[model samples]
Target: MSYIIMEIKKISSVETYPVRHEVLRKGKPIETCIFKGDDDEQTIHLGLFLDDQLVGIISVFKEQNNLFSETNQFQIRGMAVLEEFQGKGLGTKLVKEAEKHCINLNANVIWFNARENAVPFYEKLDYKIIGDSFLIPEVGIHFVMYKKIH
Candidate 1:
């Protein structure tokens, strides 16, 4: 098997939609991948590339969550890795890179509404589920997961 080098870098929010739609939204409309804070000035989107092709994506927004009293908290959203690249440590790399990015901005915490299936992945990265699972309308079950970055 040939080894492929992966490049992880900061990208524009619009650049994240294709992978997000393909892997996260699936049968849903493409517009479904365009999240609320995608264009926020304080939001940062990270894309993982393999040989110049984008394969994974995640977005971090400088936002406060009521559950966490910290004012320097950020929320992770629109995190998706293409099906073929799902278990190759690409997602872990993306989150780690995002944490570094958050630290540069002086962020103390990073949180997200993680899908049920992804809880284990986040747990491996030391993110804790803050509350019981809840349904997100058409999005199935989810948990509020968070980690301290500072």
Candidate 2:
């Protein structure tokens, strides 16, 4: 068996767009990967690198959802791992790193609109669905999922 060297680090929002577009918005306009608040001062983007090559990414924004009244909540968005590098616990490592960052910011909760197929993945990470699944125009179905990370 071969070993892979991985490193997780805080990255700029722009650094996340490439993997986000490739994995989450394939065949769609590159602009689709540019999320709102990506440039916010309080937002953070995390990238997972394997052998010095970026292969996974996730972003966290200081935002609150109306569904939850938590004063210090961070929204997780644009989480994606490259097709070849997926299913190897890289996504979990990215999330664990995000949680550490969130805790440092005093955030009590983290939430996101998770794609339907990704529900089980989030569930495995202890995130729970908040309500019924809904459709995102041109994106397909999703559910609001959250976890108390504090």
Whose lDDT is greatest here?
A: 2
lDDT, candidate 2, 81-116, per-residue tens: 999988988999998898888899888899999999
Per-candidate Cα lDDT values, in order, are: 0.91, 0.92
Candidate 2 accuracy as TM-score: 0.95
lDDT score for candidate 1 against the true structure? 0.91
